[model samples]
Target: MVASTHRDRPIGVFDSGVGGLTVLHELLVQLPQEDFVYLADTARFPYGERSQAELQEFSLQIAEELIRRQVKLLVVACNSATAAALPLLQERMMRTTLGVDVIGVVRPGAVHAVAATRTGRVGLLATTATVESGAYAEAIAAADPHVDLVQVPCPDLTEIIEGGFPFDQRVVDTVRRYCAPLREARVDTVVLGCTHYPLVRPMLQRMLGPGVTIISSGAPLARQVEHVLGSRSLQAGRTEGEGTYSFLCTGDPEPFRTMGTRFLQMPLGEVAQVDVAGGALAGGGPALA
Candidate 1:
């Protein structure tokens, strides 16, 4: 069994922005007894356009900051970052004093989609960087080589959702445009490859129709988290009381609090600001302390 003190440490989750709140929501629901510290790199939001090297650097920086908080595990909730940096992050985490496990948003969803598909055809909707990275395709192919994978790279969908929720016609049009190819492919399963896409899931469902199974990273990733924690004997011992959750953001905390509440569909308690200097957290936030 892992040390009791290590098991008592919070699970750290990070994303480029509020999008990762969707993933955190599942963690909150499924692992209510475990504390969570979520960090949003809002100062560098919209990770969809960054280069692979930039993403790796950003992810490593975030991992180090989360490690500083004594997190028992690290979750890279952004698909773009996961695609670009999962291996490197995992390697770094293994070298930590705690040997924290690093989980990301791609493989679990891919496995889930492969299981959900009836026609051996799967579709993926993701940001440009994630799609271009070919992460989902690799994951799906690894899970089931026979499964045909169709990918749609939405260059602007993340921005559209982030710009405003309760989307308008433009959002509808963008979703439709993205789903058209998937619809044409007649895929019975679709993987939502971006963490932010869940915010527009209803619109995506309508666009893709009821016959398709939509797999997002949240639910499956939550299960993986449970398994990992349990296997390592790191599950929280609390049997009744709910766990506490806190927030940290590299940008202004107010916007993160406001936007995150909407995304998580839960009251986001205090949000603390993270001072990022040279891409590393400089530790100004009370949450970071």
Candidate 2:
């Protein structure tokens, strides 16, 4: 069993890659006093195509690493990872770790989507794995079965956003194509099913038109994190100083660092590189302090 005594430590957030930065951005805005550590499993690149077992194993490995770092809370910032591993992670953590909490994006986003839709028609734009897992569909259905859901599996949107081409015409065109069916179905609200999707919110808004509302998982997820931390009394005390941000990547650090700066709208000092060897975190490189 892992023991945790830290109560004022930073929150840990992880994704298959830089997509989770969308959640991280919101967290920073909502909880400026809290520090954050973000892990991007860039070596895996996209968890969207992986098997359930594979994704769960990877999520467990990263969660263990974050636990080792003494985070007071854990946020499965990626929709695919959340859908694949949240239950197992929560169970394991509750059985072993103490004074820490784990939260995921799907349920919070689903609740918000259900609340925001006026026509009871909702659209979900997410990775192929999330759509296949039926995570959002089930969550929203549970919240309100009357909601008519249109799930669109956006294949390469994460890659495009992580590639720093989120605003390019090609990206907009792809978003337009993906959203066409939802528009035809007259969905009044669209859920940004993947964390990375928020990086292209402008494009999504344009494609969705003014009448349609686009909701990302960020704000809701951040609110959940805040609630958990507050309930546990793990919320940080107010500090005038700028909170620190730490980043880790399982692939080449340079590209992730560059793209993170672009997507987060802030300069990421340095990104450390780590490797998963034999399904465990092994090598560790330097990270910005």
Candidate 3:
């Protein structure tokens, strides 16, 4: 861990691939005054399939790199990482890091889902590890045990989205197939457990129907950021200035740059690449850091 300046530095956000861009988009809308540094671990993406130990190691390495960059706060925008590494990262930070704060998406999303469900029936769609971890179920149960929760693991959804595949007929068909149980349960609200799922909201909406509310962690996660910043008096004071966003990736930047723009609905310039060697992040050739 590095010494933190605790200055008004940019907030750090990261994901397994480009999925976290959905969270970043909401953060931008909610806190436009704050700057952000986003890192996409594209090298070992589809974190859905990685082992718990591997995910934790990768997450800690990424967190160390972000801390080195002097980010004021860290957001684990990847749900799989959140499920596997959040507790360990939180403990490590408390003991060794400075004034920076770290938060994960599961609790925030779960909180929102519990509040939003009209019939107390919530459906969760996420990666296999996330479902197996039972993070959502625990969060919802802690908030409201009365809430009926259904967990559906959509194994390959992240890969499809990250690969820049359209949420066309095939994708919709896949989602419908995976969500059949949730639909059969007659749940009125569904939680998009994976960060990548937000990118295909339209398809989800169409399949689930207008009556069934679909929620993603992005908005609630952004609200959590705002609440934390306000509580700590770390809120950016500039209300009229344009916010800046910095992008970094662990793999080739070209594909990320191309897919990122469409997902984030913003033009992305060259992205900087970082290499993870021996479970540590090393700065590679700089395109844009």
Candidate 4:
């Protein structure tokens, strides 16, 4: 693990692919003065299809790389990874010199969806692995026992969004296909359980109608991040000046840089390519090799 914390160190965020940029978008807006380091594990993209053990290994490798960069905090922006690896990741971080805090998306989005529903019916759209993991269902039940959940397993939604042409008719049809059950279930509030879904939120809203409240991990998670920083005194405290951010990915950086701007809605200054050496990341993985 790296040395103890530095207040000026960037907050680290990671996902299986570009999906996590939705979370980064919110972080950039909510914590404008705080620097961030974002990692996209695109070499093994679409974590929905990966096994739980594999996801944990990939997460630990990514975390080790981020910790080497000396981030003050870590956010698991991928639902599939979060469902499988958050506990292990947190435990590993606790043994580190810095003991960085780890935040995942399921609980925050689930709680918000539960609160947003007026008809006691909520919908969830996530990757197959995330849906199968039952993380959102458990979180929603814990938050509000009275709420009913309708979950849809989107096996290919992430891949379609990752292709970079999201506003096309095919994308709309795919979203509509996933949203049909929510309409049938009469869910008044929906949890966009996968970070990539937010990019197609307008289409989702149109299909599900104006009344359905769409809850995603970004804004609510941003609030939680703010609270964590203030409580722990880890905030950058950079008043008046905006903080900078950069990108790291295990796959080719060219496509990452081109496609990332759409999801991030901000200039992706420079993207560096990294290779993750797997197996036991308790300081085993090298930094951005």
Pick by TM-score: which candidate is best? 1
- The C-alpha stretches of model 4 lying farther than 4 A from their native spots are 1-5, 279-289
Q: Write the per-residue lDDT of candidate 4 for residues 205-262, one digit (tens) a residue.
A: 9999999999999999999999998888888856789998989999999898889998
- Candidate 2 is scored at a TM of 0.91
lDDT of 3 by residue, 58-138 (tens): 887887778668777899999999999898778665544354678999999999988999999999999999999888999
TM-score of 3: 0.92
Question: Model 1 off-target regions past 4 Å?
Answer: 277-289
Model 4: C-alpha RMSD to truth? 2.9
Model-by-model lDDT, in order? 0.89, 0.83, 0.84, 0.89
lDDT of 1 at 259: 81
lDDT of 3 at 45: 84
- Candidate 1 per-residue C-alpha lDDT over 1-289 given as tens digits, one digit per residue, 9 for 90 to 100: 5778888899999999999999999999999999999999999989998999889888888877787889989999999999999998787677656788999999999999999999999999998899999999999999999999999999999888888656799998989999999999999999999998988888889889999999999999999999999999999877889888999999989878888889999999898898644423322222222
Task: Give the total clashing residue pairs for model 4.
Answer: 0
RMSD of each: 3.3, 4.4, 4.4, 2.9
Runs of candidate 3 exceeding 4 Å displacement: 1-5, 237-239, 278-289
Candidate 2 ranges beyond 4 A from true positions: 1-5, 277-289
TM-score of each prediction = 0.95, 0.91, 0.92, 0.94
